[model samples]
Structures are given as structure tokens and as C-alpha cells.
Target: MKALRISAMALLGALLALTSFFVGMGVGVRQVPVPKAIPAATPTPVPTPETGVDFSVFWEAWGILEREFYGEIPPAEERMYSAIRGVISSLGDPYTSFLDPKQASVARQDITGSFEGIGAIVDMKEGKLVIVEVIEGQPAEKAGLKSGDIILKVDDKPIENMTLLEAVLLIRGPKGTPVKLTVYREGLEEPFEVTIIRQRIEIPTLSYKMLDGKIAYIKLREFNEIASEKLKEALRELIPQKPVGIILDLRGNPGGLLSVAVEVASQFVDKSPILIERTKSGQEKLFKAVPGGLATDPSIPLVVLVNGASASASEIVAGAIRDHGRGILLGEKTFGKGSVQQPFTLKDGSELRVTTARWFTPSGTAIHGKGLTPDIEVKAGEGEKDVQLEKAVEYILGLRREGKSDVCEGCGKQP
Candidate 1:
């Protein structure tokens, strides 16, 4: 991993999936988007006696556990929360789950783009906590954390069986304080230790660099609240340079707010019905791009880089670009997460993200389990070289186009 020493101001952050790596839902994908397009779904009505369900069995078990348990009983609140999680889990939809107040707070703060903690994104894979993305020049990179490194311990404490939120809280601390991570890298003989000093980290919505030939390359991390404002700032600076082409990198982005998705995409696409949404009741709505976009000229060269991790809001942007024929997508297949989530604040300051609808491309393709197929399918391996990016540069520079279809056919969708 290339070490980056970030100079931007930091915050006290306990990095989760999208915010907290950030949250696991619209509350952050890696949507970490609240509603910018569709209205938030109304909270589910409380269970009424008319509903045919038995609570006697649940009460009986609870009573028995309280009376005859072998060990000390958990607090009533924890037990109630666990029951709620169990009920939610029974629905079998991974995206629809509950978060307690603390997790909810982290999810909300992530959109602000400022936080404190080691600057890294992590997720659970096969029950192991693994580092996914390390921000350039962040404490995690400075302390030598790498993508795919498995975190076995934090502060010498085993993280086994802890939830993602629990682990993140344990790893996070006050700024300038040190948190020790015991990591197991692939080629290492034994787990090693790395100590990272926490800082106030303000995660950038996007970072841009001008490539050779004045091609503007932007790497967008998430569609947080400040995303549009930041992108406008970046575009204002880059567009004045009259760049020949643009490359948008959304490789590991997990997605954020849906409204923000449309807003960010508006910069590139000017047409209506950038996306479609379908509720379980069959009602449908077509979302259009808002007015006053920064870069709506389709003639400008553009390529979006996506991988399996590019999901939700990111997918919405990529799909819109393809369906509108505004740009071509490069790299691997995207993470197919087309369902729409609505955030409902519970009474306890906790949050519940429930899947309310499924979204589609303007062309009417529903990418739930099946991701969008890139126009140029190029896969890369871990190394010093980025083959997909190189290919994009070649495409923009007119270097390689021998019998390949770079343009989308019959893809323009009208509302």
C-alpha cells in the first residue's frame, strides 16, 4: 500500500462501514444517501391485535429465562434490543436491520465528512474483520495498514464474536491517543502489531488529480451530504482548465443517499428519469436530474470505473451514465444493490433502515442480484500498476479501440 500523509483537518472518528467503514445501509453503502429523490417511507405501523401473531410463547420463554437461567441475566434493555434484532433478522433481508442510538449517531455524522479515528474502511468477511480501503496519507496508511489485512485484535483484545459496531467503537478513541491493531497479513508467518494514533479525520467526498493530457480524474468515496457541494468545488476548479476528458472512480464506494445520487449524477446527465423506483405495491416513480448541473455536456469524454464494491448510489450514477449514453463504464461488474431504503428514527434515538423499494436504470433494468456489465470489461490484480486506469487513459487518448464496443446501443431512455 502506498503510504499517504493526509494534511486535511481530522475529527474524533470511530470509523464504521460507511461512517462508523460507514454504516451498512442508505445510512452509507460503504448510501451512506438519505432521501434526495424519493420521499422517506412512513414507519411501519405497530402490531395490532387484528394481526394474527402470538406473543404468549415469547413471554413464556422470557419468563422462563428470567426464573431458571443458569447465569446472570442480561439487562432488560439489551435483551429487548436483541429480540428486536432477531425479529428484524428473520425477514432475511440483510440491508433491512436496526441500529441502536450510538450506531445511529455515527451514521448521521458520516455525512458531514469529518470524523476522528484511523483513516481506513473495514468490513466483516467470513466472520473476520478486514481492512478494505485506506485513505491516502491517513493514520492507517501512515501506520502501515493495508487493504485485505485481517484485524485479529485491538488493543490486545480479541474481537471474536463482537458485532461490527462493537469493534469499531473499541478501535476508536480520542485524538492523539494510540490504538493498537493486531493484524494478520496474507504472506506473514505470524500476526503483527501496528499502532495508529487517532486524529480528527474529515473524509473527502472526492479527490481529484489531473493526469497527463489534462484528463481530470476524480475518486469519489461516498455520496455523503456535502458531496454535491464538494464536487461543484472540484468541477469549478477543473472545468476552467478545459480538460479533454474525465475519469470518475467509484471502485470501492458502497453508496450513500439516493437524493444525493441524483444530484451528483445531474452534473453529467441533463435528461429526465435518470432512474426508476418501484414499490412493493407496484407504484412507480421516475427520478429526474435537478437543474443547474456543472458538467452536462455529453460530448466531453468520460469513463466511470466500478467494481463489485460499487453499490447503491454509486450504481445509480453508473447506470444512469450508461442508460443515457453520457459515458461508458469500465472495470469489473458493480455491486448489485438496487433496493431503496428509508430511514425511520425510532423512539430511542435508534434508527431502522427498511427496504421500501427497488430502483432501476432509466432503461428499466433492475440490477438487484445482477450488476451492470461494463462497456469495457477490464480486471486488475494487486500490484503497483492499475491496468484498468491505464486502459481508460488509453481509451481517452485514442490508443486502443480495435473491434471493441465502447458505446452503449439502444440505451437512451426517455421518461
Candidate 2:
């Protein structure tokens, strides 16, 4: 019996040796197959009364968890997270996501002027990992990352099939961490590699310049900490010039920090409701502009410039001004992103950025996907002088010549 056992062990050892020899010669191990592209399908809209769930998978997952998990398993909230991910994945919209606490916290910090990263806004456009916007003073901006740069790889990993959020997760890391980005730029001959050190980026929220002598052009990049204060500083410096009009540009801006947006919007609107939140329980919360919140020269004719990139807080400010008849919106339609995201922190130091509520303009117009249209439609191409701003200035000057006052006729206020 001992001899038979010895013989079996010897045979197994021989087999292992033979397998190792063949593997060293590159003959035994199977090569990993390259992944093929899966075309994106159009998302079927989930019906209203939005539990926003797929019950079959949810039940199956729950059953599996209840049966297989060791110890006490997890709480209901954790189970719901798995269910929510399954539901959101079913929608097939890569951009629309259900972030758990960890992911939510990260996303919130990304917007809140915290966290260290390459500092590029990326989104899945036509199934490609594309750069939406590069934050000024970020490592990406310093590396000459452009607005339409397609990200092909992170470090050495091919990101062709990865979603934007996933790519961001892979790219973002601790401060001073190095990341190599392989990007395909439009005018570049070949794909290039950029090695960047991650750092905290304070997104530029306000850009100002004296335009054509009589107009101050302030391009709001995004709503962030001290955005209102910065804007006020710009106004303070510009008002002395006694500009005929103020052109507030919101082109190519993805909104951020709702409170800042509200403060900025209040600078244009008088004592009136700027936005209203409609909750799931049919409750409405009104965000009204406080009295004496307008700029010192609120009656100084104003024009807001918007385009396809203008979204969220940008829409809030634009919508408020338009609804209040306080300013004329002059660019193309704004990027209508009106839903509010709430960030929940997780034990793993991650976050979930969940869309909690939808917001509407004072006139009850929801600007989610269907963006705000300009009062004076002015089409302008890239690297071109925004004709919208020009038209707005023309309109304001025309009104001034016609002896029409700058006050809101509908609101009967000075702003």
C-alpha cells in the first residue's frame, strides 16, 4: 500500500514538472482572449412611480445573500445598495448611476474643491471616454489636456470598454501619486502619454475681463466655494467702469455647488422664488431670492450667455434671471441638468452620489435634459466671439436708446 502511494506521488510530481516545462516553452498555458466591443443599446424608460427597480434580479440577489452570507450578513441598506446597482445597470445608461456611500463621497469631494486628482471632467460620449472639461490649474490643464481629448488608457490598462466613472476611479489617487494617461487628441499625429502628479484642484469658477469698453464679460466656470464673493468682487471692480451692460457667460460650464448657484442667482433676481424642488411625496420647497440680494447696480442691463455645455447651477442662474425678466439669455440652449445629487459617505472612505430630487424654474419648467433655450438665439462656433453676448448688448443698448428702463417689467422690481 505504501509503495502504491509512492508511485502515485511520483507520477503527480512528474506531471507537474512536465507541465512546468511546457509552460516555460509557451505551449501549455492558454492565451487570454481580447475583449470585443459591445454596442450600447438605447435605454428603455422605467415607468413612473419610480421605485426604479428590477424585481426579479433583486429577489434573486436577496435570496442568494440570505442563503450564502456568513455571520450576520449585512443590514438592509447594504442589501438595497446591491439591488440599486443592479437596477441602474439594467438601464444601460452609463452616465446615469446609483452611487453607494463611498462613491457618493468621492464625487462630492470632487465638486467641493477637495480631493487630489488629475482634475479632468470626463464623460462617456458616444461610448468613448472623452474629456468634458479640464479644470484650470489642474495637472491635466498643465499637461495641455484639451476639451475633446479621448482617453484610451490609464496607466497600462486599456480603458476602451470602461465607463467614465470607472475610468475616473482608476485615474484618481492620493496626492503626489503619478498616473500615466494615454490620450488621443484631434490634431495630434499619434496617441501621447502624459505623466501627471495628482493634486488638489480648486476649479476656477469665475473669469472676468472688460469687454468692448462698455461691457464687463464675466465667464462663470462653475459654482464653487466663494463663487458669489468672487463675482461680487468682479462686479465691484467693473461697476466703476460704468459699463452699459454686464455679459455673464456660462458657456461650456458644468454646474456645481447648488448653494453658490443660489447666491449667484440671487444677485440678479429680486425678492421672488428662483427655483422650486418637487419631492417624491409631492412636497414643494421654494428657494426664493432674498430682498436686497441683487448687485448694487441691478438695473445695469445684463445678458447671460449659455450653450450646450451650460448645466446645473448654470441653468439655475440662467433660468432664474430669465423667469424673473431680470436678464436676457443669448446663447444656444443650455445643458439641462436640474436634478440634485446628495452625497452619502461610506465606511470605506468612498461615497455615493445619488440623485435625490428634481428642481424646476419659477415658472414650473423642469430643465433636466431639455435645457433652457435662449431668448435671442445666437449660434457661435468654437474659438468664435459669442454672438449671443453681442446680441444681448445690442438689445440692451437698443432698449436704452428707446428710453425703456432696465427694471423687470413683470416682477415690478428694480433688478
Candidate 3:
């Protein structure tokens, strides 16, 4: 079986679409590079079984088009690439996609979290480009872009029939330049226009502060490369303060590297299985927690905050903590994105990102298309304060008062 690998530089809904892979490690804002001409290589013949249908019709059509078509015939290599894409599309799995050389390069930039754009995460839902999140302190947030805003147009051009990558390319531009967007918000009767100047966005992974009640508040924005290290630093600083509880905020975080997910979960879950991976061949692999975690002390109460936008690596960590009785999950159901994607680089520098496996919580709950439900489901009303965070704080304080640090066994069991 192929090894499961996550994109090293995936963005969370900041580039094209708000799907798990798109936000976690697939989309980015860098301009696609020009395709370079390469030396032709020998074609590998397709092997057909004795009972398989003949593929002569396809070749016949290609031959006829080359000989008699009036229009300029595309190169055979280009046509082959299109055929490969069509084959992948037949799988009906959006996460399994073919990226041209240019697209692959752009994807690499996405996970790096340094690009020139409005810095808003977006997703394609019901044929519309919807905003999933706005990176805080970025141009999109400063310009008042909010989640659930449907993008109708870019720069006065309607985005009809355009793919997420195409829309992303149009929205991203050089720094200090303005990109106009028309969006339809949930409460508004009509679509409105917002012009935002693009800038180089460098997304911060994590932040921590001591709250009023001696509770440490740590907001993890993404499960990128620096996430684990930053978390360790935060624990080093705040744990010494002897905080009674810890509130981990994973709301609106799209996921990134899978290894980073395990590292993040290890911080709270002591020597236990953080995640389980089941491949196509029915082989199960366990990702166990490493020792010497900074926050593995079971006496420290932990509360994790999640929402509809929390996905992939976010769900992994949340589910692990909840399963191990390490923390209580608060807020809404997570964005169910449990499949693993591994990118295979083709000879021509393009990539085929294929789904290789599905991950489950230690308690054996599958999270694909069905997200993790929170222990305390606190829904936030429109224009309302963060009732979820407040509830987490309240729960932590109550636990402190009761002299309880861990949730009871079998609490918030998987349905």
C-alpha cells in the first residue's frame, strides 16, 4: 500500500475551495508556472484483460480527428493529459485530482502560508464559491470578509463555469493591488461588492495567553510545520504559570500535515494511540503518542473548541483528545474530512493526488463526510458573542471548582 502523505504547504480555505484537502494542504495563491517543454518519453501501453472491452474506439476517434478535423489538432501529449484527468474524474472523489505542473507548484506554495492574496479561505458548495474562513489580521479579515459569504464575481467577471483553481488565480494578484469581489451574504437580500487590496499573507499557526481565571487560552490556527513547536513554546510559558485549565481553540482551522496532527495531539494525550489508519487492504496502522509531551499532565484540565470549519488534522487532534478522556470538545460538529491523500509526481512534473486511506479516532470512529460531534454543543447565533468559547471557559472553571481534571470515562462516546 502507498504511504499516506499530506501536502506540506496546504492552506485552510484561503485559496480555492473550502473542502478538507483544499483547506488542509492543497490550495495556494502562487501563480502557476509556465509549463516547460520536455523531451518525449516512450508511452506505456495499457494492459487489457482477456474479458475486458476493447479500447480501439478511443484510438479510432483520435486517429480520425488527427486526419480529417478542420480545427488545429492538439498535441497527442496534451490529449493524453486530458484523458488522464477524465479517468480520475470518473472516480467521483473530489480529493483525488490531477494537478498539472503549474497547479502542483501552486499547491506547494499553499501549504507554505506565504502568498499575495486577500487571505480568506473559500470552498465550493452547491456550485457556489463560499467563504470558509478569513485569516485573522490579514487583508480579508481587515476588509470584513466573513464565513458563508458566497462569491458571485471577481473583478466584474462572473465566475460561472470556472473551477476553484481558476477563480483562485483570478482573485490572487501582486501585493498592493486591489481585487474586487461581489458576494452574497446570508442575511443580505442583494449581493454587495468589496474591494480589497492584496498583500503577502503569512499565517500564524498558534497563539496563547493566560485568561482571567488562570486558564490558559491557546488558539491553534493550522496544523502546519511550525504548529507543534509553537505549541510546545506556549505550554512552556503558560504551564509554569500553573494554570488550572487549558482551552484549546481549533475553530475555523483547516488542517495541514498529518504528521503535524499527531504531534499536536501528543501534547495532550500521553502514551496512547492518537489516530488509526486503515488502508484498502484492511491493514490498520496506529499513530501512537510520543513521550515527553509538554502538556500531557493529566491533572491539567483541557477543553477543545471546534466548529463547522474545523477539519482534517483539526478533527484528528480533537477526536484523539476526546477519545482518550484528555479533553472535552465544545462547539459545533467538525467539517468531516477523514480521507488521506498522497501526491504522486508524474514524470512530466505534474501530480496525481490520490486517496490512499481513511483515518479513525482511537475509539474507532470514522470522520469522513461525518464530522466529530462536540460534547457540549453550543451554537453561536448571528452577530452573537462566542457562546462556545464562553461555555468552554465555564466548563473549565466548573471543573476546577469541583477539583476534577479529567472527564469521566466513556463520556461523549462515539455514536
- lDDT (Cα atoms) of all candidates against the true structure: 0.71, 0.60, 0.73
Instruction: Choose the strongest candidate by TM-score.
Output: 3
- Clash count, candidate 2: 10
Per-prediction RMSD in angstroms?
A: 6.8, 18.0, 4.8
| Pick by TM-score: 1 or 3, better one | 3
| RMSD of candidate 2 to true structure, Å | 18.0
lDDT of 3: 0.73
Tens-digit per-residue lDDT, 91-197, candidate 3 = 98767877788666665555554667788776666667777777778888888888888889999999865555556667776789999999899898899999999
TM-score of 3: 0.87
Going through the candidates in the order shown, the clash numbers are: 35, 10, 12
> How should the candidates be ordered by lDDT, best one leading?
3, 1, 2
Q: Report how far residue 322 has shifted in candidate 1, in Å.
A: 0.6
User: Which clashing pairs does model 2 show?
Assistant: 100-352, 101-351, 101-352, 102-350, 102-351, 103-351, 104-351, 104-352, 104-353, 105-351
Candidate 1 residue lDDT tens string, 273-329: 878888899999888788888777765678899887677778888888888888888
TM-score of each: 0.85, 0.71, 0.87
Tell me the lDDT of model 2 at 394: 78
